[model samples]
Target chain A: MAEAEQVKVLRFWASPWSFRVELALKLKGVPHEKVEEDLANKSPLLLASNPIHKKIPVLLHNGKAIPESLIILEYIDETWTDNPILPKAPHERGMARFWSRFIDDKCVGACWMSCWTEGETQQMFMEQARACLRILDDELGGRRFFGGESIGLVDISASFFALWLGVLQEVAGISLINGDEFPNLCRWIEGFVASDVVTECLPPRDKLLAVFQSKKQAILATKSMVY
Target chain B: MAEAEQVKVLRFWASPWSFRVELALKLKGVPHEKVEEDLANKSPLLLASNPIHKKIPVLLHNGKAIPESLIILEYIDETWTDNPILPKAPHERGMARFWSRFIDDKCVGACWMSCWTEGETQQMFMEQARACLRILDDELGGRRFFGGESIGLVDISASFFALWLGVLQEVAGISLINGDEFPNLCRWIEGFVASDVVTECLPPRDKLLAVFQSKKQAILATKSMVY
Candidate 1:
């Protein structure tokens, strides 16, 4: 019999990007070993595997390294035929890619910066973030999830909103995702986190909260020192 | 006989992102109608087609719109399999996507900004742009194309460097792509723009230069008014 194809993931615990890759793997029932990296002092394997960005999560399948979480997700879906993460039709697949990129390009950074910044800057980013959330809520409409019945590409890509954004908002003492303002997205957060595959792999909420809280505290300390 | 599929592209002539979509279609021999958008006053059709971003080029096939250039390119490839722009292997396809994104996320904006900014800011962006060019040159290595013998995803995505960057650099009186510094990249650009499909679709060099020159003049006028 042929040896099982070796699969491994290089990841940091607190990254939502890493979470996306893990979720995709678990969803597909791809049994892979996980290697946690010290991002502050990255390993040689990590560096050699991904020289371009030198960032995780890098997916290694039979010694072939695939970097970038979105790219990794697509690679996994393409390689493993069962439990498809992306839709079948070309147009639907294109839309899936479009929304996934939208969440990354428009939503994530704006929402993230809204937490880290203050005063006018924070307000600017907050508005942008809110606008994005509103658009997302509209897109979700009456669908149970962004992927309809299953948690697929956009849901996986928007995993940051399902977990990290909530934690970061709490740490920063902001409420970007009010149930009233973004009812669909709020409901999505509930459904997405409670899903089995996601629940198994997500970093514990308290741990994520602690990480962001300390980071926020450090940022505040730096601001006080400067001003 | 059944009616032929109605294929259209909402585009602005000078936009490299738009150019990418056009080149892919032409390379695939897919007949398409081009509707040039008045970017200052965008049409309702363009707005309706891509409600999320409202930017071109939007590919309308049988009236189903696909927005974002890279997404459109993928859609085009999947929908029409002839003259494949992406490699057949899953890993190679993933790499193609990675490099295409790298060019967009890292190279284009930095190179464009390097042309427009001045003094310390210009120097900072210039260094970043140069670093990106060096990395791209190294990746090109000895390959006749980034696609290794034909124009493909990375070659198409990096089209900005082939035409627009050269025009912008000349207009700004800066020399970022010296033949010695990025010989492989320079050679790739030469071959890429000289290729039949690319050569046929590219905007006239003199017209592009005139457009950038007027924009630079307007920017200088605004700067002088401020400082």
Candidate 2:
């Protein structure tokens, strides 16, 4: 019998989910190939890997495709058990999942400023989004990272909040992730940015900002035309 | 110390999530006191149990409130090992979680339908909800339950779709879950209803319909005022 092949990740460079998966793989010391995807003209492999989601950050492990960035993280943590992402205690594990699911529910799913037709609908969502961040800030009170000291799974999963939120605030002409207001969370962001592992793995903030700028510009152009 | 105290469940009569926790407790043979909540004016305990959602189906085991219906299900299954809802295998368990999460994401979350305004929104959600039920029908094709012949944790978790969906469809004045279109699903619904254990525990359809009627009327009244 031949040895099984290693897992491969199909990802998009600009996607924060792609970055999170990359960070998890790196933390676990899992060696795998990364195939960058072009969202404009999606690769057949990417489409085949995740026909349902049809998005990036699809991990092909031993030829079996696992879509959903969070799902991929779980797979990585499970397969490469050396560096554990989940807690040992079942209750603690559940709590970690609570936070992860919270991020997915609050931060990721609900769009704030984007696609808001009016100031009210958009502002309401924006305020709600800010409120959610406030909860995170409180939860991260006095802690170096969401994991307390070192960067842990929840911190890794929320890496997007640190990167994209700031950029989005800039593009949308509003500040949500204010360091002064959320001292603990802000410090955590700084710590994560300065960390060697995170710094090395992170996609350039300027590049991300450029992408956000272009997206907003395109949206604005379309809005002008339609109006 | 007297080996700690047993957990109690605070629930509403007509809620499917409440029934899910109850079914798990009944299956596990765990002793619990049920606290019925007034939907009109929620109790303090209910509010304390789930501050975020402020909804029913809160499982209070060992005096600690566990909110989120699925999280509550996981807790009940974990605390009592009589009949495990989740499999020991990580992969199998992940698949179960994936499907459960999918239901929450696609159907339970009201993803597709929530976007539309009146008229179209009602029809859209109905169709989407039907598609979801049809998918379940296919999953249950030629099978007794979702977990195979005998109902398992997933089966209990998904039981809501059978009854509540029908009620919601009627309330919205749209038809989906067409019995002819979903033979297996219809059979599964009957199979669940036929099970003495489940049948005995369920609330009367007329009562449930009354509950939904009141809720739907309240929402429509509020929306009409707003518009």
Candidate 3:
């Protein structure tokens, strides 16, 4: 019999990017240990494993370390083989990768920025964030999820929109995805959260909310000092 | 015989991103049509093919468009597997991707920024750029290219370092790579350009230099006005 592969993830609890790797591992049923890190004071293991970026989350599998959430997800998919997160067909896979990149490029920063800015700057980023979500909503288009019926790469890549949307919106005091406006996206979010594997690994929402709430207070304090 | 796959690339003249797709096609012996776009006046085809980003270097294969350079390179590699750009082993491929992304995310912008800034800022970015190149140089070790004897994904991904480095350095009046400083990188550049397929598709360095020279003048003029 073959020995079981040793797997571990160095992650920070509040990070959406870290959440991506966690979800991918759970979805693929790849059992591994999790080493939670404090962003303020990173561990030596994380510093060594991901010396380049020095950021979470880094996946340590069988003595090799893979950093970057998207890269780790791909590694997980390739290693596990079953419960594939990515599409099989080459073109479909390209499309899936495209949207995932699109979300990272277009949406992630703007979503966070919308939460941190004020007045016209806040409105501008909020509108930009909305435009991005609208495009995603359009992509969802009558389907149950981005991957047709199941949560696949793009869906997992954009999981932040589903899980963290409410907390981000509440803390930021900005609403970008009301059901009436982004109906398909809202429907998809419900399906994503309700999915079996997703439920198993999702960080408690209330805890996530508390984390973001404190972040929001920090942002407010910093802005007050600036003004 | 089955019908030949119709491959067309929509590209701007001087984009390193476009060069990536071109090199991939050539390396794989995939014959394709090139549609050069006036970036100032983007063609409808470019816009239609890549509606979201409206960026150049969109690869149209059998009427289906795939945007983003890295993604297109992967598509080209997958479709035409004779000259494999990515490694066969999944772990090696993951490392290849991680470095490619590291270049895009960390190096490219800093390389360009080093050129356009002056005084402490330029020095800072130059150091950053050198630090990145040093890491890459260390990766190369004594190998002829990033992928060993022959050029592969990491080598192709860092194609900008080979061709654009001189032009960018000349235009910006900055020197990031030299014989003593990045010996392995310097050695790799000589090998990369000498490769037949790369030489065939490489844009004329003189013309590229002229373009950046004019752009630098414009930047200087704008800065003078602001000050």
Candidate 4:
């Protein structure tokens, strides 16, 4: 498995999912070529590589494209095998994988939850999202990180709360990840951003805020246009 | 590692997630014991095993319990050096995982989209669910199965869609898994149900449909009572 040819990753600049793959590659200390995809006009290579989702954070190891951010993380962890992302014990590893998947499934697109719903409906899902955060914060619960001690796979998987999308609370006008409320998660976020790996890879705070502003505007525009 | 004891899994009756672990176990031909959880009150063992979710299916390899359906699936594949549920190729394996996670994330509650919402709100989520199903159907286009040829982890992972909750479509008065539109998927479903591993483990369809019906009615009754 160690021919060790250079790796290539197709990614979007502002996507949290893309950020996940980027963080993994950097943590594993793997050298990778990054190709950014345009959402409006996707590249042919991106399309060909990921014909199904036709989305970004597709890792090409020796010219084969792998879609899905979590999958990419797993792939990176397996390939490098040092500074292991997932726990070694099969069941422990499974617990980590489950939570990571839960985050991706339940919380990954929460920034978009408000965008996708309105009135009472939005309120319902928003409450559901808060409960998810509460559970996550509980999961963090005095731990230095989700992996505990060193920031590992699940922490990287959930770094969205640590980075850009966290600012969406302002844009969406929801205060879910409150520091006083989710004390452990708040500390976890601080530790995550403070880490050398995260600080290096994270987009500038102002830039991320601007992205959130634009996305919020777009979402409002979607509803506005519908009306 | 070679001397590690065989794995065992804690599970619940009528849990699709448990079914997920079961299928993965059978597919991989992993040597394991299945401990069924009593959801009526929950067992102390189950509580200790999955203190977080207090749920099943939890995978125990060498006496550690791993919670969450998807995570257990990964653990089974990893621990058992038998038939691999995940692919040997890293990226391809990621794709399998990604799809499985997508199914896990999007397939909420067996049948109903929203028990509370009425008119446009429910309609919107219904559209979203349709979009998801459309994507899954397209991804499974022209293939013998989701895994291609033989049933793999993804097929086992998503088997709930075919057997258990497929009846929920009847309960919901919505038929998203249309045989005519998704002919390949329909064929795959039939093939899966006919398979020995899948067939032996499936809850009787009549029982499943009855439970789903009772559950749906309960949801409706609870909503009505609240109003």
Candidate 3: which pairs clash?
none
True contacts kept of each: 0.91, 0.00, 0.74, 0.97
| lDDT of prediction 2 | 0.72
Per-model TM-score of chain B: 0.95, 0.86, 0.94, 0.87
Which clashing pairs does model 4 show? none
Deviating ranges (above 4 Å) for candidate 1:
A219-227, B219-227
Runs off by more than 4 Å, candidate 3: A219-227, B219-227
Record all residue pairs in model 1 with backbone atoms less than 3 Å apart, i.e. clashing: none
What is the per-residue lDDT of model 1 for residues B1-227, given as tens digits with 9 covering 90 to 100?
A: 99998999999888888899999999999999999899879999999999988888999999999999999999999999998999999999999999999998999878877877899999999999999999999999999999999899989899889988999889889999978999999988888878998999999999888887877877554531100
Q: For residues B163-187, could you state the per-residue lDDT of candidate 2 as single tens digits?
A: 7767766766655666789898788
Alpha-carbon DockQ of candidate 3: 0.79
Q: What is the interface RMSD of each candidate, in Å?
A: 0.4, 2.4, 0.8, 1.6
User: What is residue B125's positional error in candidate 1, in angstroms?
Assistant: 0.6
Q: Give a tens-digit lDDT track for model 4, residues A70-181.
A: 7788888888889898888875687788788678667755545744577897887777777778888888788898898987888988877787556766767766677787
- Cα TM-score of candidate 2: 0.87
Model 3 agreement with the true structure over A1-227: per-residue lDDT tens digits: 99989999999777778889999998888898989998778899989998998889999999899998899988899989999999988788899999999998889777877878889999998899999999999988999989887889999899888888777878777787799999998989888899888888888999888887776777666642110
Interface DockQ of candidate 4:
0.64
Clashes of 4: 0
Model 4 interface CAPRI class: medium
- Model 4 chain A: weakest 10-residue lDDT segment is A218-227
DockQ each = 0.90, 0.32, 0.79, 0.64
